[model samples]
Every structure is written in structure tokens, then in C-alpha cells.
Target: MAEFRCRACGQEGTWVYDPERYTCPACGSIDVHFVVFRHELPDDDPAAKRMDELATEEANKRPKKESED
Candidate 1:
């Protein structure tokens, strides 16, 4: 399972895969975004170190863009 947030209503929680459709459970909004639940960097792992550097500090805190009318 992965976490997701409803961009329209600011609801955040874990989500299971649904083959039928993807919609926010809070307000039934299709506009939603993913959330990373964990981040770890192992000293003995080179790949983990590289991933830590590549990951954005504000990946989850980014402001949503306004939709054009």
C-alpha cells in the first residue's frame, strides 16, 4: 500500500491499489498527490547515500499549482 493526499481537500492517508478507479476518499476528488512514508540512508550502502542526496527536501511540501480557468 502507498500513501496519498487529496490535493483539493488536504486529506492524507494510506491507499490500496484499486483497478476500478482512483479517487480521493475524503471528498471524491480525482485531484490527488502521492506521499512518501519513509526515508532512510544506510552508511554502508552507496545507493542509499545517492538517493538521499537526490531526494528533494520539500518533495511533499510543494505548493499546488492553481488550475487555469
Candidate 2:
């Protein structure tokens, strides 16, 4: 896990692994950069737990628009 700081709001948080884009939550800015090698997280960190929860929620929120099309 990596940490990232929002340039706009200066709020620090964990980095999310997204293939599309990397956006900051603090200020909703996309001008965020990775703060590499800042700290090491344990296997049971709260941020990791929150990430898992968000992922699960997103997966469940996906709309099933079509069957086979």
C-alpha cells in the first residue's frame, strides 16, 4: 500500500489501484502524485479494510442492464 496527498486539500490517504485514473478524494482533484516508500502498512490496516469494503460495495452496485445481448 502507498500513501498519497491531495494538493488541494492536503488530506493524506492510501493509494487506490485503478487502471483508468487516479483521483484525489480530499479535494476531488486529479493532480495528485504518489508518495512512494513513505510507510509500510500491516495486513490488517484500517485503510486496507476500507478499500476492501469499497471494492465490495462497488461490485455490488454495478447495474445489470442486459442478460446476453
Candidate 3:
């Protein structure tokens, strides 16, 4: 199962294997998304902003690593 949260209604939960329809159980909205990729959310998103803060903390705690690219 994958963690999900509907962007429209803010409903968060775990979803079963991928199906033809990945909808929110609370409002049946199609804005559901995996929580793991929340870091990829728009910069204005709260979750995305938090991820950026955490990343900055980690980077500051250690020596700068080479770019993945």
C-alpha cells in the first residue's frame, strides 16, 4: 500500500495497489497523491516547504556532497 493525500480535500490515508481509479475515499476526488513524493509538490505547498527545510538542515549538518547530476 502507498500513502496518499487528496490535494483537493486534504484527506490523507494509505491506498491499496494501483487500480484503474485512484480516488479519495473521503470525497472521491482525483487529487490523491503518494505522500512519499510530497517533496515534489509545488513550492507554495506546506508539505513541500517542510521538505525543503529538512533538506537544508541535513545539508548544513554535513559537508557539501557532490551533485547527483
Candidate 4:
């Protein structure tokens, strides 16, 4: 999975695929951009995991925000 940052809220998250067209959860913006990824187990970064967890948690807590037209 790849990590991404929402240009709208500056919130970070992980994606199984490119999130270029995905909308930001915090501010409902489609200006999301890919950040980085984990390549090795020993290199497992806590921040990345935290972002993933926060993303999932936030997603579950809020309604799906629609993409801006």
C-alpha cells in the first residue's frame, strides 16, 4: 500500500492504489497526493501505520464525502 496526504486537510493515509482522484476526508477535497511506502518489515514506520489506522477510523466515523464537481 502507498501513503498519501490530502492537500485539503494535510491529513495522511494509506491506499492500496493511487489516490490521485480520491477526495480528502477532512475537507472534502480531491487534491490528494501519494507520499511514500514501506518496502521492508524492519523498516516499518509507526507514522505510516498510524496514518492508516487514523484513516480507517475516520472513514468509519464519517459519512462518505462526495467529490466536488
User: For candidate 3, lDDT tens digit of each residue in 1-69?
Assistant: 557878999978776534344577678888777644653356776666888899899989998768867
Model 1, residue 12: distance off in Å is 0.7
Tens-place lDDT digits, model 1, residues 16-36: 634344678678899987543
Q: Estimate each model's TM-score.
A: 0.43, 0.39, 0.41, 0.33
Per residue, candidate 4 scores C-alpha lDDT tens digits across 1-69 of 667788778898775643233565456687877654434212245655776778789989998768857
**What clash count goes with each model?**
0, 0, 0, 0
The lDDT values for all models are 0.63, 0.64, 0.70, 0.63
CA deviation > 4 Å runs, candidate 1: 35-69
The lDDT leader among the candidates is: 3
The runs of at least 3 residues in candidate 4 whose Cα sits more than 4 Å from the true structure, single-residue gaps closed, are: 18-21, 25-28, 35-69
Predicted structure with the largest TM-score when compared to the true one: 1
Which 10-residue window of candidate 3 scores lowest in summed lDDT?
Answer: 13-22
Prediction 3 TM-score vs. true: 0.41
Q: What is the total number of backbone clashes in candidate 3?
A: 0
* Cα error, candidate 4, residue 19 (Å): 7.5
Question: After superposition on all CA atoms, what RMSD does each candidate show versus the true structure?
Answer: 12.7, 9.8, 10.0, 13.5
C-alpha root-mean-square deviation, candidate 4: 13.5
Per-residue alpha-carbon lDDT of candidate 2 for residues 1-69, written as tens digits (9 for 90 to 100)? 557788877888786544344677567788787543413444366655666788789989998677877
